[model samples]
Target: MLLVPLVYLVIALAQVQAGAYAAQSTAIDAARQAARQPEGAAARAQALGELHFADHGLESARWTVELSCSGDCARAGSRVTAAVEARVPVPGVPQIWGGAHVPGITVRAEHTDVVSPEES
Candidate 1:
């Protein structure tokens, strides 16, 4: 009946949401860890490489690392932000019944820091 479809829809939404959150959590954690490193660019690169979340029907892309600094960036003189995008797939069954087409979901994560010049 109608109630049966409602239950299925809720479960599907929950799954996609959970995946999005997991991706965001991983990206944010890696970004924070990278910022805490004094190596600046090198650290950023490492963070980008390390950020990842796995999904069965979702495809994940590489993470982006942003640094707020000028010159050599030898010191932690600014903030940092990292973001990653993911496309989660929703099965066609739910979409056909719900007309949701909930075919894809995107997730992004960001982290900021107050870097001090002397924190080099």
Candidate 2:
């Protein structure tokens, strides 16, 4: 017989995905702010600091930020990015899922903020 608990497990998995998305979104916001400033050590630091605050609720790990000239990102501006994958165990479907199996959600987002001459 198909277990009904499995249905709940699927729902939980979806929730995890939401969490990942939220975290990445905050990271992007920080990147956008940083991009507005000129590429420099201090500017990057401020941007990253803001991002950390934004990711307070979401899982924050392996934060990444880069500055590029031309292409998708211009040097005057910068790109901010964050990535994380979290594995959440099914709450009520342990038996249905068999051992330590659960759902894994991975998310990544990039933000590009224009760097003003003075900001740089």
Candidate 3:
């Protein structure tokens, strides 16, 4: 009887956890793809696009991406890193309450890849 509400809450929390996992997976994939790209702007745009495609409910505006390259990024053998941070939305929960807004869980991921030395 009393446990029913608790069960529902647990289910809701699990859904939120699933969303967080999805966001994290998307971030990781996006970072890895961006790190493998040669152009900066194109890479960022493509990564964002991919993220949005994979997670439609997740807002692109809430995500931040950082790209770092060791040495010349365009040069072969250079290492590139892409870091992504995103706020995972809780299902059925609004961000605002009582004139104040609550924040969602933050998930972050990073990937590093080396340019092919022989490719360019």
Candidate 4:
């Protein structure tokens, strides 16, 4: 009886932890990639693509990346910021229920990197 709930609790915690790690790493990698790119649109696309490469058990479709720049993205010394957000579903939850009805935890991370002077 109690054991079942405990097992579920552990599974849920593990999922949350993995999702958090994925969000953080994705944010860092995406920011770095964006900082290296000269175009905002290209940078955003690259950052979004990074989600598919994340090792954690994240569903890329459930994630979003938002970007902001200190100035012209291509300018040396400018900083590019990437914010990643994801909704991780609880294990054993059926998705047939709409997302609004499904239980999930929201995880987010943000990272910033400066544009390299040589890239300008």
By TM-score, who's the top model here? 4
Estimate candidate 2's alpha-carbon lDDT, on a 0 to 1 scale: 0.46
lDDT, candidate 1, 1-120, per-residue tens: 799889878877875776567566655664565556646544654444444344433333333434443333344555555555555555444556443444565555555544455532
Better of 2 and 4 by TM-score: 4
lDDT digits (tens) for residues 1-120 of candidate 4? 899999999998998888888778778877888888756644564555455435675553267778789998989899988888878878888878786767788988899899988823
Off by over 4 Å in 3: 1-36, 42-56, 95-100, 118-120
Can you write out model 2's per-residue Cα lDDT over 1-120, one digit (the tens) per residue? 457667776776665565556545544555555555434644554455445535543333233434343333335433433232233333444445644444344444544445444442
Tens digit of lDDT per residue, candidate 3, span 1-120?
Answer: 999788878875775565556545655555455445666644664566456535654542255666677888767778777666666555556645731344556766666777665544
After superposition, candidate 4 runs with Cα above 4 Å error:
40-54
| Model with the higher TM-score, candidate 1 or 4 | 4
Best by lDDT: 4
Ranking by lDDT: 4, 3, 1, 2
lDDT of 3 at 59: 44
TM-score of each: 0.56, 0.43, 0.63, 0.82
What lDDT does model 4 reach?
A: 0.76
Models, CA RMSD each: 5.9, 6.6, 3.8, 2.7
Query: Which residue pairs overlap in candidate 2's backbone?
Result: 35-113, 38-119, 38-120, 68-75, 69-75
Alpha-carbon deviation at 90 in model 2, angstroms: 5.7
